[model samples]
Structures are given as structure tokens and as C-alpha cells.
Target: MKIDIQKDWGKIKSHFRTCNRRNMHVVISSVDSDQMPTVTPIGSLFLNDDQTGFYFEKFATKLRKSSEQNKNICVLAVNSRKWFWLKALFKGKFSDYPGVKLYGELGEKRDATPREYRAFQRRVQSTKRLKGYHYLWKDMAQIREIKFTKAEKINLGKMTKEL
Candidate 1:
């Protein structure tokens, strides 16, 4: 069964935790009513205590904060990749620990501790076997909300239809 975006916060958080298996989430973005949806692949999602807001590390994104344009977006997460369609949903809000569409604003983000920042940078350094990999980490474009529906919501259905 599918759950409403605002009513299924805990279920959505648990789906991303990968408590018993590999976990990953995909982020979707649409700037306007008529704009096309933007999808991003992510490996990590930070769910805070109390099931408030969540955070993820992204290297680059199509939307930047300087534009002042509202980025209507939704994030889809899954607990296991084995199940092609685990679960996902639409979301909005922007603040620290906000249950709804309130994941803090975009652009105005603080950097990890100087030491931690350096470590992240180093972890992204190029390797002999792999070159030209994107090694940048930036604050998530102020996410608005997250939904916990079948992964098919974004993949099999019209969740990403071009507007």
C-alpha cells in the first residue's frame, strides 16, 4: 500500500536505514510546475534522532541557491537494491530536523570540520584504476519533503513525467 507524503515519515526513514541489507536513495527535483524532474543517485542519507530532518552529501546538483527560484523536489530511498522497486515518495520542506518539507535552505551550508572536510576530500582523491570521478561535496539543495511509497512511484509511474 502507498502512504501519504506527510503521514509516513517513520516508514520512509526505516526504508533508507538498510538495517538488514544494502541501502541507497535517489533524489528527484523539479524547479517549476512545467519543468522536468531531475533525479540524483545517492549512497548515504543521514536520518537524525526523533525522525526530524535528514541530510545527504552531494557532489554537484543542477539547482543552485543564487537563482532564488523555488526547487520543487522529492527524494526516493530504498533499503535494498535487490528489489528493483523497494519504495520512495514526493517531499517538500527545508529546515534542520523538520518532519515535512523543511530540510534547511540551500546554499547557506556549513562545511564539515576542517579535519573532516579534508578527510572527505582525501577519500575522493583519484585512484590509479579510476580517474575523473566527481570528488566534490556540497550541502543538499534545501530539500522540501520526502515520501515513502513503492520505488515504482518514481520509476514505473509518471512521478518523473516531463512537465
Candidate 2:
């Protein structure tokens, strides 16, 4: 669908904030044997936004671990559906979709803030975080950029685009 990407980020960001059990898209960038950049999908990213870069809690999966070795990444996320997600990705690049992305390095830190601590507790107790969370964030390396795509084409079958 043709889209005008001007006023869709707010709606998309809201969706990411309230999602549960939804699979978020991740693009972990690393060097191949030849030292060229390689990107792939890694599941387990959770959105935590307050007033800065959207924070994500990730376990040590192969993708995360591999990315950790390189410290460069560009992650993507969108509400999933048959029609909306027609392609596994957009335009063969990181910023091709109407979603939020963070381009930077990775660092670890405690999920120690008061509000986050309680939320973590609830997550663990509610069986939401699976094995539970330990060092919270993993800092956003550099949080190089964070933004959303336009809303004119974010369709989900019967759900009209939120333009």
C-alpha cells in the first residue's frame, strides 16, 4: 500500500508500549568472516519507554550474544498481521518500516529504578518474563536514533490504517 509517513509514529509507539506476548522485530548487526555488516532477526526484545530511547530487555540468545560482540545494531518492530506484514522486512534495510528503531551499542545495567523494579517483580510473578530478569537494560550503547514510520499504510486486514 502507498503510504505518507508523516503522522504515524505516536500511534505506533503507543502500540509498542502496551504489547504483551507480541513478537518484536530485532536486527542484530555484526561482522561476517569478511568483516562486513550482517543483520538478522532475534526474538525477546521488550519495549520500556519513559522519556528517552525505548529500552529493551534481551536475554543472551545467539543473536544478542553475537551482536554483543560487535556493539552495533538497528532494531525494528511493528504490529503483526497477515496483510500488514506482507514482507518479512521492508526495502532490505533497517529503516524501511513504519516502526521504532534504535541504532547504537549495547551495555548492561540493573533494572533498579523503583517503578521498573516493581514492574519486574510483577513480570516475574505473573510468569511474564519466563526465567525472570536480572541486569535489566544492557544500556542502549549510544541510542544513535529512535523514530517511527508513517501511519498511512499500517494495515491489519479489517483494521483500517490509523492515519
Candidate 3:
């Protein structure tokens, strides 16, 4: 289903937030020059209020390369919460979509703003006490922006009729 990005932006953000809260990785898809598709699991994608988003560019080498070759990208965020699925199954329908696909074009890579950096830090604060947190997330000082073009609700046949 086609979604008005401006009107339904809040829902889109909610979907991402739900997935992020569960520590689920958002999947980003891009095609290389040869038309082969590459999918990357990203944990740092953040949606802005104006239908644009950014992801910390620390270890996404393949994603960055593919995006440079082809700016078009599709991001998929699935709720994947057990309670959400169980409730939907019992009702035979979903109150909201289980997932959403965001179509967008990648923008330039730039140093992240202090606000953005702090936001990222806050998101991963719970893991700060772990040693890997510094090794993995400390250098995520750069970000790549994405200007969304469209939003599509992922339909699951009759399971999504109520949505």
C-alpha cells in the first residue's frame, strides 16, 4: 500500500522505533553497478521528522560502496516483537503493519552533528558498560543521510486485511 510520507511519517518512525527497541537490525538494500543486490543489517539508522534519515557510518563498508555506486536504497524495518505477532495472530489481523519499506536516495557522507552523535550515544547507553560497545560504536562519528521518496506497507496476504 502506498503511504503519504508526510502524513504517515509518525507511523513510519514508530515502526523503526519498535524494531530498534528490540535491538533488531534494519535491513538496507542496494544494487551495485552490475545490478546485483546487496543487503546490509544496520543498527544505527535513525529517522528524522521530515521524511529524511541517517545512519552512523562506522562499519558499513559494503553499504557505503553500494550506495556510492547507486544512490537508490530500500530500508526495511520489521517489528518482530513476539507480543505484537501473538496479538495479531489471535485477532487474525494486525492493528498496525508488521513491517514497512522505505525507498530513498542516499546523500553525502558528513561528520555527524553533536546532536546526532548524542542521540546515537543515548540509544546505545545500556550497552555502554560492555567492552565491545567502545570497540564497535565509538568510531561512529560520521553519518550518511537519506532523503525518503516513498513509504510502502509490507502486506502479508489475508493477514493484513484489517490493517
- Local distance difference test scores for all models: 0.37, 0.42, 0.91
Q: List the residue pairs that clash in candidate 3.
A: none
lDDT (Cα, tens digit) per residue for candidate 1, span 1-163: 2344345555545554542135424444435333544555544334433433333335435544321465334454433343332232322221111111222233333434554444334444443245334332432233222222222222232433321
lDDT per residue as tens, model 2, 109-129: 334455544543454454445
The residue pairs found clashing in candidate 2 are: 5-150, 105-141, 107-138, 108-138
Please identify model 3 stretches exceeding 4 Å from their true place: none
The Cα error of candidate 1 at residue 98, in Å, is: 24
The per-residue C-alpha lDDT of model 3 at residue 5 equals 90
Two-way TM-score contest, 1 vs 3, winner: 3
Ranking by TM-score: 3, 1, 2
Global Cα RMSD, each model: 10.6, 8.6, 1.0
List, residue by residue over 5-121, the lDDT tens digit for candidate 3.
999999889889988897558999999777899899999999999999999988888888888679999999988889989998998888888989999999999999999999999
